[model samples]
Target: MNGSEFARPIVGLTTYLQQAQTSVWDVHASFLPGVYIKGVTLAGGIATLLPPQPVDAEIAARVLDRLDGLIITGGKDVDPATYGHDPHPTTDEPARDRDAWEFALLAGALRRHLPVLGICRGAQLLNVALGGTLHQHLPDILGHTRHQQGNAVFSTSTVHTVEGSKLAGLIGETSDAQCYHHQAIDRLGDGLVVCARDTDGVIEAVEMPGHDFVLAVQWHPEETLDDLRLFAGLVEAARNHTTERVNLWPPPN
Candidate 1:
């Protein structure tokens, strides 16, 4: 392989494993929005789709062994039980398998210090994985459904980044985010600090301190297409990770 090809970081993106309808048949499928792949590629990383599957710490570690970074793409609501809560009446039915799979993958990534970027449901999952709780239904708390307009439509959110957060360094102080989530971060996760929030004070971004790179956002960066700062940041970190890995294993002269 050419130097450029070998240097390009391999980033694993989580996919939705669900019933899907296409061309001539409907079946349970593993799929992801093209925008997620576009974002990663446009930012100079090789996109690798990782569908939900039977996984444990060892399996997740093996998976991470081939990846330089991880992106937890948006999907179904995180099961409330994940964070020690009962399901809210409006909550989406549990995708326990996906939850378990992703939790394992994330644990492996964290252990490896791989860069991670979580979006929407992904952001919620990160919080839950780190011993945090979620609001479950924003409309009930905010008294409006502005964060999510329903029926697969995305709403615009003006999020202001925290002054000294890693996210602020990449996307500046403010960003017009494309959001489609009905739940928001409630209690802060362990070692996680809020990096951005909407006008309503709903947490929009969170990051784990002392990690190589672990940032998750409530908004959908892929949907915004115009802004790729978040994806670019992830790719840059992953590239650095790749460089470090190679240096640690020198090829014989």
Candidate 2:
């Protein structure tokens, strides 16, 4: 409700490319579940859907040029080849197209230092893109499957936030969170630090300190309507970015 939200930043959310099925339609499409758009819009920002691209760096830069904030929404497993690892039998098939497209997008966003909020698979993709490795199968390492509930639903986990971390004020020091992930970050990436975790020590959130706003979480805030700080935080950061951009290049008198 402060002045930071006055600008109503345009937040670009990336989508998936796959076969979609509805009662009257079944076809290949580039799309995201409506939850992402709902979350951004409810948080006092304009949401825009960004379809996947075909590994084009120039296009990625042009896309970031217009976006004040970026959201890499969840999707299929990331390609292990991205981080020099081989596929695991338990790992879901990699979506190479999405991986490359998002990687390029992340690269562009990072170069511009734009605010970025990543969720679920988006978190994993951010990690991999920044030179981190993945466990590929959490059940194998933890001997439990609580992190991933079967079929289209989120499981609950008591997650603890790191004190003084960027997410502490938003997600709290300890809170029950909705989660659904089979893989997790193994070795963290460059410029990223853990901000929270579940009881089992699985990394829950990460942030790139000293950046305007670059954060990722294993859970999806967009799925729950009660939380808006996460999205609002990005919006505020984007507003600051917009102000800086305008000052750097004033319009002609």
Candidate 3:
């Protein structure tokens, strides 16, 4: 069957676990922005929300067994402790459970060779998962707040992708990125290569070599729904993965 004829790939998205109030109900909830869902659907993939939960390697593996791809969505700051650093004064309080949950899921996804995309905080987590460090606060280093303009505000950045990198091939060598990240990758992660960077020299994207699709960007691509190139690329890779799995172990007729 051709690509269009294949079943819609199941793309799992990690969500934020926080206190939310709706309809007179105030309680902790697992929720993600609608833009992320729309982005996945528009890219021709089935969206599945994976909230923060108690997950180990075994549990994560079971979850991956059902997904064709994984998206580590943007959210709160990752605990600096995970990378052997004390919390910066400007850093938001850490979401330890979410961090642990995502790390486990990421480990399983990597072991299973699943197509994975990370955005904003997702990008930072991916780097930390690979034994990398973060700058904690970009404003402190850049002497400006351009990377994170203000409360609930996203700034535009001129991002330059490395030539020949997967990210460059998908979004071109230069693109205006929607960014809202205060922390960024400080030390290079093992097996991960920088694929994109901002004009100010901040790492904007990274990917693990030899992986089918393991791209992570510091920008919030979901904010720009009009450009579905990144999402489409992920769904396409997921579709190919589905095809290969089916070929290797045909389903019962």
Cα displacement (angstroms), candidate 2, residue 36, comes to 0.8
**Whole-structure CA lDDT of model 3:** 0.93
Q: Which regions of candidate 3 deviate over 4 angstroms? A: 2-5, 250-253
**Would you list the rank order by TM-score, best first?**
3, 1, 2
lDDT of 2 by residue, 1-253 (tens): 4454367888999998889998999999988889889888888889999887666988898888998999999889898888999999977787788888889999999989999999999899999989999999998999988888778888988889889888897767887778989999999999899998999999988999999899999988887778788988888888889777866675657
- Please report the candidate that would top lDDT against the real structure: 3
TM-score of each: 0.96, 0.95, 0.96
Model 1 error, position 134 (Å): 0.4
Per-residue CA lDDT of candidate 1, range 28-98, in tens?
A: 99999899999999998999999999988888999999999999999899999889999999999998999
Which candidate number would show the highest TM-score if scored against the true structure? 3
Clashing pairs in 2: none
Steric overlap count per candidate: 0, 0, 0
Candidate 2 least-lDDT 10 residues: 1-10
lDDT of each: 0.92, 0.88, 0.93
